[model samples]
Target: MQTILGANGQIGEELARYLHNTVTHDIRLVGRRPSAVNKTDELFSADLTDAEATDRAVAGSEIVYLTVGLPMDSAMWEERFPVMMENTIAAVRNHDAKLVFFDNTYMYPQTAAPQVEGKTPFEPRGRKAAVRARIATRLQEEMDAGRVEAVIVRAPEFYGPGKTQGLTNTTVFNRIKKGERPLVPVSADTQRSLIWTPDASRAMGLIGNTPDAYGQTWHLPIDQDRLTYREMIAIASEVTGRKIRFSTIPLAVFTLAGLFNAPAKEASELMPRYGVDNIFDTSKFAAHFPEFETTNYRDGISQLLSP
Candidate 1:
C-alpha cells in the first residue's frame, strides 16, 4: 500500500489519481480532512505535525509520499515545516516505508541560472526558503547516511486545470479567463520554466515506484520550450480567440503594494524571481525517463481556458 500525506492539495490529489490509475489501488490518503480520489482509496485523517498521528498514517504503507504545502506565510512555515518533516521522516523510518518527497524551488537562488538538481547550491534568501533548505538538507543527510530509502522530486511554479494556484495561474490565466488584462510580474521578456501539475505528479509517481531512483534529487520534467510572459500571453490569446493585453508589474510597484496587502507581502520574497529568467533544468529526469512527455504552453493554456 502507498500513502500520501497532505492529500488535499492539487499535487497530492493528482499524485493519488496517477498512482491509482497506473501504479496501485491500495492507496491511503492522509490529511486533516482528505477525500478519496478513487473508490479503492482508504482515508486517514491526521495532522502530520503530530508524531503519533503521522506514524499511524504510515503504519501499513509500503511507500509514503510527503506533499504537504502550507500557506505563503513565513512564520507559519518556520514554525511547522521542520516539525512535520521530522515527524514524517521518523514515521517513514519506523514503518519501513520508502519515502517520496515532493519539493519546490523555493530553496534555490533567485537568479537567471539554470537550476540543475545537484549542481545548484542552496542560496535561500528568506525565511520560507531557509526552512525549505533546512528540511531538504535534513532529508538528504538521512538519504546519504542510508537511514531511509527516499527520493526528492522538485517542480517549478504550476499551471494547470482545476484549483491549481500559482503566480502564473492567478496573474495570467485566471485574469484572461475573467476578460481582464493579465498582470505580468517584472518583465514579460524573461523566460519561465513551469511544470504542468499532472506531469509533476506523474513523474513523482514514476520515480517513487522505481527502485533505482532512490537516494537522489530530481527536477521534474518540464516542457523544453520555455516561454516568456509575452509569448505566453500570445498563446492564450490564440487559444481563447481573443487578443489579451497585459501590464507588467515592476518590482518597485509590487514591493510597495506588499506594504498594505497580506498576500502580496507574503509573496514579496519570491517577486525577484519573476523579474529574471527561470531556467529549471530537467535533463536528468529526461535522461532517466526517456519516454516521459511534458505539456507545452499552447496546449496547457488551451486546457486552462477550456470549460
Candidate 2:
C-alpha cells in the first residue's frame, strides 16, 4: 500500500484520485482528519509533530509519500517544519519505507530568467529561502547515509482548480476576471514558470516509482515555451471570455505594502524576482516520464472557469 502523508492537500487529493482512478495502488491517506475524507477506504489520522501519533499513522506502509504540510511564512518554517520533518523522517526510517518529498525552488538565489538545476551558488536572500536550503540539505544528508530512499520533486508557482485565495485565485485570476489588468511589477514580456497541480501529482507518482529518481532533485515537467506573465494573463482572460484591463506599476507599491502588511512585507524583498523573468528547465523529467504531459494553458484556464 502507498501512504500519502498530506492527503488533504490540493495535490494530495489529486494523487489519491490518480492512484485509485488510474493506477491500481491501494492508497491509505494519513492526515489530521482522514475519516472526514469521504472518498477513501483507508483513512488514518495523526499529528506528524507527535512521535507516537506519527508512528501509528505510518506503520505497515511500504512506500511513504512525505509531502507533509507547513505554513508558507518564514517564521513557521523556522519553528514548525524541522520538528515535523524530524518525526516523519524517524518514522520512515523505522518502517524502511521509500519516501518521496515535494519541493519548491525557493532556496535557489535570485538569478536571471530560465533557471536550471545546477547554476549559481546556493545563496538565499530571505529567511524562508534559507530555511528551504536547510531542509534540502538535511534531506540530502539522510539520503546519503542510506537512512531511507528519498527523492525531491521541485515545482514552481501552482495554479489549477481548488486554489484558495492567493496569487492566482485572488490576484491574477480575480483581476483578469473583472476585466481589470493586473498590476504586474515586471515587464509584460518577462517569462514565468507555472505548475498545474494535477500534472505535479502525476510527475511525483511516476518519480516515486522510478529508481533513478531517488537521491536526486528532479524538476517537475513545466511548460515547454517560456510564456511571459502578461501572455499568461491574456490567455487566461481569453479563455474566460473576459476583456482584460491591465495596469503596470513600479516596485514602489510592493515596498509600501511591505511596511504595513505581513505578506506584502515579505513580497518587497523579492521584487527583483517578480520583475525579472523566472523559468525552470524540466526536460529531464519529461525525458523519463514520457507520459507526463502538462495541461495546455488555455485548456487549464477553461477548467478553472468551469462550473
Candidate 3:
C-alpha cells in the first residue's frame, strides 16, 4: 500500500487520485487534517510533528511521500523543518517504508539557465533553501547508510486552479484575479521553467515506482518552452477574455515593504530567483518514462481559465 503524508494539498491530492484510480494501489493519506481529503478508503488525520502520533499514522505503509512543509520564516525552519524532517525520517524507518520527497529547486545552485542534477556551486543562501538542502543531503546520507530507500524530485514554479493562495498566488494568478497587472520580479523577458501540477505529480509517482530512480534526484520534466511574463499575461488574458493590465513593481519598494512585514520580506528575498531565468533539463526523468508528456504552457494557461 502507498501512503501520502501531505495528501490534502495539491500535489498530494493529485498523487492520491492517480494511485487510487490508475495503478489499483490501496492508499493511506496522513496529514495535519488528513480528513481534508475526506470520504476516502484510506485517509487518516495525523501530524508528523508529533512522534507517537506519526508512528501510528504511518504504520502498514510500504511507500510514503513527504510532500509537507511550513512557510513561517527562517526561524521556523531553523527550529521546525529539521525536526519535521527528522520525525518523518524516523517514522519511515520505523515503518520500514521507502520515501519519495516532493521537492523544489531552491536547494540547487543558483542558475541563470538550465541546471543539471550534479552541477556545482552548491551553496544556497536562502534560509529555506539552506534548510531544504540540509534535509535532502541528509536523506541521501541515510540512503548511503543502507537502511531506507529514498528519491528526490525537484519542481519549479507551478500554477493552475486550486493553487489560489501562498507563494505562486502572490505573484501570478492572484494578481490577475485582482484585476492588477502582476509584477513579476524577474526580467520581463526572463522565461521560467513551469510544470503543471498533474505533470509534476506524475513525475513524482514515476520516481516513486522506479527503484533505479531511488538514490537520485531528478528535475521535473516540462515542455521547456520559455515565455516572458508579458507573454504569459497575454496568453492568460487571451484565454480568460480579459485584458490583464500590466505593471512592474520595483524590488526596491518590495525591500522596504519587507522591513515591516513577514510576507513581503519572504516574498522579496525570492525576487532574485524570479527576476532571472530558470531553465531546467528533465532528460533524466524522460529517459526512464518515455510515455511522460508535459503539458504545454499554452494548454496550462487555458487550464487556469477553466472552471
How high is the CA lDDT of each candidate model?
0.93, 0.74, 0.76
Badly placed stretches (over 4 Å) of model 2 are: 35-38, 118-121, 164-166, 178-181
lDDT digits (tens) for residues 133-192 of candidate 1: 999999999999999999999999998877687999999999999999999989999999
In model 3, the clashing pairs are 186-274, 186-275
Q: Write model 2 residue lDDT over 23-104, tens digit each, in one string.
A: 5457789888764333554888878879888877778877777776565577877886777778778888888888888877
Query: What is the C-alpha lDDT profile of model 3 across 216-253, one tens digit per residue?
Result: 78888888777877788888888878878766667687
Candidate 2 CA-lDDT value: 0.74
Ranking by lDDT: 1, 3, 2
| Collision pairs in model 2 | 181-245, 181-246
Q: What does the lDDT read for residue 270 in candidate 3?
A: 67
Query: Which candidate, 1 or 2, would have the higher lDDT against the true structure?
Result: 1
TM-score of each: 0.99, 0.91, 0.92
Which regions in candidate 3 have their CA more than 4 angstroms from the true location? 36-39, 164-168
RMSD of 2: 2.2
Winner on TM-score between 1 and 3 is 1
